[model samples]
Target: MQFDLNRITRKNIQLLKPYSSARDEFSGEAKVFLDANENSLGSPLTKWYNRYPDPHHVQLRNKIAAIKGIAPEHIFLGNGSDECIDVLFRCFCEPGVSNTIICPPTYGMYQVSANINNVAIQEAPLLPDYQLNLAHIEQLVNADSRIIWLCSPNNPTGNLMNLEDIETVLNNFFGLVVVDEAYINFARQRSLISLLPDYPNLVVLQTLSKAWGLAGLRIGMAFAGMAIVEIMNKVKPPYNISEPAQELALKALDEVGQVNDMITLLVDMREALAAVFRQMPWVEVVYPSDANFLLVKMQQAHLVYEFLLDKGIVVRDRSRVELCDNCLRITIGTEQENTLLVDALAAWHEQ
Candidate 1:
């Protein structure tokens, strides 16, 4: 279908003249700097952090573009994907008027962000198989529906949403389609990032927190058409990502091979953990996962969750979530951690 970004983008945002920083206007290395009002005497910490970081994140975006096969202009790096998510609400959804649709038993942040922005959120719960309910989604969409959030290899569910269903939404929906791939590194399916060229309204988000082991760094990626990226940049803080985050992200990019090896190990561990869970009579279901975690349906899930907690073992109790009754979301931990969890469950079963 025809996707006109102007139709959904907030009128005030379209006319907004974003705040420009000193670094935004200048480039090239300099020996003595006296630009944006700094201490100039250098910071107390080793290595000068006296100056503000590059607001545009030039080097980080270029490195990411080279790896992802997208232009730097198409990338918008946020403090975390949360920033990008919030900015989208600010840029498109008009508070108390324009609304967004989200598939439930998915991520919670989408709903939280919508609430914070005062945008109405329409719920289209996933099918029993944990796939998109496209018909319901279509019925929910209206003139004021500005965005639709889909989480593949979905959180707490640990399964990828069917691609055909996603494509159908993109092909039919006039509003933007945001596909969050936070756990894509562990998934077998290819990222929808490659399809950005084919779908102008598509926005794919990924993060460094999971596979890269950089949760502390808090850098997230948003890949889209240059138009979307530019709009996001306009709405984002001038210096959202810190200097340390940019430096570490660049270093992590250099070690892609190491990251790949870690992913392979985690996938193996995920399957191994699933195998062990299947043997337990108490485990009613060990849902197949394209993620680094598993959603296990157990008998007396609340009791089991408490038992594990009492043993100093932690797992999310998602039994109250719709369609995930009696379920606990378990992360693929190290071998020792996994052994501890398994042993704890075994002991509980014995009792």
Candidate 2:
């Protein structure tokens, strides 16, 4: 399918001007702010809370640009990656007129987001090996299919899709290829962020939530061509990220050594947990992972899930998803947490 990038961005969006706050006009140092209406007395919540945040989040984007080797112009920050996902639909896709394609047994939100936007979701379920079905996906795309959501080191399966297969989709598809790399920091493959220059429709979404252990901070990032990102920026509410989140993320970026150390630790723990799962008598298989979690297949997923829940060891039962039978998506916790999980499984099996 062929598409001219300019022609496909929603008509209303192309003509519409984004709301401009007074702070947006002059970005340099400012004092005696009277721009946007705000409490003259600083809010008790936080001194920074009294004022509106940088509607564009310029400083945060630059820090991310340096780390990712992408330009600040290409970066977009959202309340979470989910916001970025949701906005893409609103920006380019016309509800009931446009559609999207997603792989099943992947992130549920991709499907959920599409549904919420009234964008019909078409599926080209991943092959039985849990890898992308490129041929099938090609068949699914048409003029109305506006985006394709691909999760690398896919959510419940815990496996990275072949990069070449993804490039195939990019080469052929006219619409945006949204790669949700929420877990890419844990993967060995180089990010497709570098491919942004190559594919105008490509958008790479990452978050500090996963690898940096800042899920609570709710900082999600999307990197793409400036044109596509501009549409998203237009739709996103101003002051999306709080000042505290910006402050903490700035601090976290400085603590790269600590974050890298933690990744190493989690990788070690992940492997240890994989080995333990392999030794369990009821365990059928432990899928290989490039993320912080394991997908373990066992004999009785229901009983095992219930047992773990009883013991206060929470894990996802993803057996209902296609190609993932009797599988439990287990996040690698601390040493003590993993030990308790292992012991719980051991005791459950003894009964």
Candidate 3:
């Protein structure tokens, strides 16, 4: 498909002049700094923090580029994936005029971000089997449809959307196709990042929050064509990523081997937990998962959720969510923690 970013982008954003920061103005090595109005005296906690973080995340993006096998120019850093979602809406969806499509029983943030940006939403609910409804999606696309959000190893469903289905949308859609891969680290499927050369409209979002265990750092990444990356950079705040966050992420990225080991362990625990649940008479179904969590349909699932809560164990009650009736979403915890959960569930089963 010929994806004309200019055709889809909001007019104001296309013509907008981005804010120039003190850091953006200077690039050479400098011993003395007078520009950003930092105190001559250093900060109380850390001397380095007195100065502003890099407005562009140059160093961090380079590090991530090396890891993801992409050029630094293709990456856009955000405070979190939430920020990326909101920025996409601002850049592409003109408020009230432009609309985006989302498959139901997917991530809640996509709809939340769209609503916050005053962008109309069109629903294309997932099929009964938890895959994209391509025909329904195609029907919903109109001239104003600027984005279609897909979640892989999807949030509540915990299964990757079929690769063929995703490519069909990318092949057909004229506007941007955003594939949020928050749980990609756990999935066996290859990320859509490699397809950037083929699809200019494809925007792949990943995060340090999941496998890297850096949720508190609030770092999210959006990989897209240079055009989309440039627009996202223009819309984001000057210092969307803090100096500490950048530093911590840099350190974490160096430990890929360790993270991979943890991922293996989590996957093991997830399967073990699922096996135990499968044997339980109370568990109606233990949905297949490519993510860190499991979506389980059980007898009186809400009561089971309450029972676990009363014992100080918490799991998501997704019974109210579409296609997940009488279901609970459970994240795979450490071995000991998983044992505690199983013990609690066994007790509930006995009751």
Candidate 4:
């Protein structure tokens, strides 16, 4: 399934001229930076933050490209994966003319972004078990469908959609297939990133927020053929990533071991907590998790949720979300935090 790689995306985007800053015109070692006006005296707060940052965030991209084994050109850094997701709809889907296919009981932002873009949405709800309904999805897509939104180990479900199912979509859909892997790092499944080169229509979304513990940094990375990336790069704010975020994320990358240790702790906590939740009589089921969170089904979900809130423990109430009735989404916190949650639930059940 080869796409024109060079073709297909919005026409307005191709003819658009991106604002060029002095920094945009140059890269590599420079003696004295006289680019986008910044205090040469340096900020009183931080010397490193004196200047305006690279619009393209090349350094951060290189670091990520090295880690992900892809060229920096194939990457587009956004304020968050949300931004990239939004931009994709903005760039490709023509308002009132094109639509996107989303599997609901999945991520809400996909629908939100599409709505904001004024792009129509075609729903293909996940099967009862929280897997893609490939047959239904195929039926929903039309000539106007320009994007197919997917979330692996999906947001509320905590389950991975079969890889083959996703591949089938990519192979069949002529539109851009945006696979949101925001939670991929926590999962053992191989990222859809590797499939980018194989499917030009593939766009894999990732972020530093989850695995790297840099949510405040708000850095989201998207990998696709350079063509799609270039289009997004043109549309995003010149300095989408603030200076401090770039610095912190880059430094965080340096301490890769620390990040791994944190993930290991969280993964261990996730498993331990899963076991505890399952043991509770009120807990009907604890969905398997590959991400930092768990989606749990309980007999008295609403009552338990209110009780936990009363105890100052906050977790998502996904009960009203389709296919997740009476389910509560819980993120694996520190060891002590998990203990508090477990104890709270146990006490609530006893009451």
Candidate 5:
């Protein structure tokens, strides 16, 4: 389909005059730094955090762009992927008017963000096998649907959405196709960030929380066309990302090799743990995962969840989630932690 960004972007967002901060007014080295009414004497703890963070995360975005082989102009950083999700809604979906499509048994934040923005949500629930129901998705698309949320190596289920199916939607959909790859670091399929240049409507969301071990930092990324990035930046809080988060994320980006090593170890552990679950009598099915987690369909799944909780262990009880009845989602933990889980399961079985 011929994509016209201006046509798809919300009218109010199109006319938006973004807030310009002191940093936005001036960039580069300065001596006195008498701008933005800072403490100037520095914070109670350290002088370093006295100044506000860069409203435009130049250094962090450039570093990430280098790593991801995308232009910094294409990147938009948020407090986390959730912020990115909210910003997308703010930028495109008009509240109580425009809508977005979501494939459920996917990320919860999509629906949550849509609700928070008062934007209508159209659900195209994933098929029984936990992949997109493309026909259902197509049927739901209309003039008002501004975004379609797809989570790869999807949460709860832990499997990647079929790449071709994603491309098909991208090919046909007139609005934004946001493929959230928060767990892409563990997945075998290549990120759709590479396809950004080809598809102006594609927005790829990723995070440092998972494989980078920076959930505490809360740095989330959105890669899209420069137009989309600009609009998102326009709507986002000027100093959304914190000083320490930007610094820590920059440092973490430098250690790609270390992160990859951890990913390799985690993927190995994930497979090993899945194997153990498969052999367990309580596990009815251990769904194949391209993510760092496994979704195990268990007999008495909620009871197993409670039993594990009693044992001081916790895993997501997705038994009530659509298409996930009697299932528990378990993240791949450290070797000792995995063993502890297995031992706990064995103990529960013995009971």
Candidate 6:
């Protein structure tokens, strides 16, 4: 309940004086720029890209803040949500000494990032129904554990973690509780971003890669208390987001109606796909999903995966992931793509 950021953050990070760009000092309109040693001549490319991108992501964050109803100061735009995850480990977890909690059959990056940072990972796997095992999670929380990772509308599983269970962790654990909401735009539930003011230790991760259809642009957002956001900003590389990415993201944000319509179409297609999978004899289970994908258990998952691959249709083989045995994670593709997938499966069935 009482989250003291000073106590939790790494000592070296606490004292660290972040790299400040020339842009950090002056914030206003300037006719001619001579500050950061950009070529006075424009770039060879048609667009002006000779000057460095804004390190602070001022315009982009302000646009996001207006939409999310949060202050720009509380937002940190990373190269991807993966960057935000990595920065948290660097800023909080002391290598080898500090540890973090990860509920596996969840996102893979949390484990990968922890290993890269040399932070110990404690696994508190999801329960039988693919929900949080809160008691086990609470019991795993020790003094050395610095973060707990939760993925809602979880990857591979395609279900949202219960909000009450999340609140329980936030209340009991003094350390960081990162809720990855990468697929939140497709979910029915409201985002925990609205509760950032209530929980200081909470960090909500989101991305443009999913419903926004901007994976190539690679813009991810971390919404947290200003204290956490400031530290993340401090640790990140200057110009983490490219000028083209920012420009495109701003343009995408203005087309919320288009994004929403796309999401509605995907959700409908997801349901339709699930119905088709259910009718197939090989599909043992089609798990309930609130995201843009479905996790279906196949009778012979590897064979099915190989079959799909040979047809030049790609879907994730998540059969090896925990609690997702014999599963294929299928994204809700466009109408034609989905038809191709079903037709391929039907062809497999005929043989």
- What is each predicted model's overall lDDT from 0 to 1? 0.93, 0.89, 0.94, 0.88, 0.93, 0.93
Cα lDDT tens digits, model 6, 219-277, are: 99999999899888889998899999999999999999999999999999999999999
RMSD of 4: 1.8
lDDT of candidate 2 at residue 98, scale 0 to 100 = 92
Candidate 4 residues 194-304, lDDT tens each?
887789899999999898988999999899998889899888988889988998899889888888888888888899899988888878989999999999999878888
* Candidate 3 TM-score, C-alpha based: 0.98
**Candidate 2 Cα deviation (angstroms), residue 200:** 1.4
Off by over 4 Å in 4: 1-7, 26-35, 39-44
In the range 1-351, model 5's lDDT, one tens digit per residue, is 477898888888899899989898877798888888988877678445988899999999999999999899999999999999999999888898998999988889999999999999899999999889999999999888899999998998999999999999999999999999999999999999999889989999999889899999999999999989999999999999999999989998999999999999999999999999999987899999999999999999999999999999999999999899999999999999999999999999999
What are the per-residue Cα lDDT tens digits for candidate 1 across 198-278? 999999999998888898998989999999899989999998999988998999999999999999999999999999999
Assess candidate 6 and give its TM-score to the true structure: 0.98
Q: Note the residue pairs that clash in candidate 3.
A: 153-160
**Candidate 1: which stretches are off by over 4 Å?**
none
Which stretches in model 5 have alpha-carbon errors above 4 Å? none
Per-prediction TM-score: 0.98, 0.97, 0.98, 0.95, 0.98, 0.98
Write model 2 residue lDDT over 1-351, tens digit each, in one string: 574667568898888898887777766787777767788788767454776777888888888899889899999999989889988888888899998999988999998888899999899998989999988898888878888999997898888899999998898889889999999988888789999888888999999999999999999999999888888898998788988888889888888889999999999999989998899888999999999999989998978999999999889988777888898999999999999999999999898
Q: Which candidate, 3 or 4, has the higher lDDT?
A: 3
Clashing pairs in 4: none
Candidate 3: regions farther than 4 A off: 46-48
- Among all windows of 10 consecutive residues in model 5, the one with the lowest summed lDDT is 39-48
Count of clashes, each model: 0, 0, 1, 0, 0, 0
Report the lDDT of model 1 for residue 286: 98
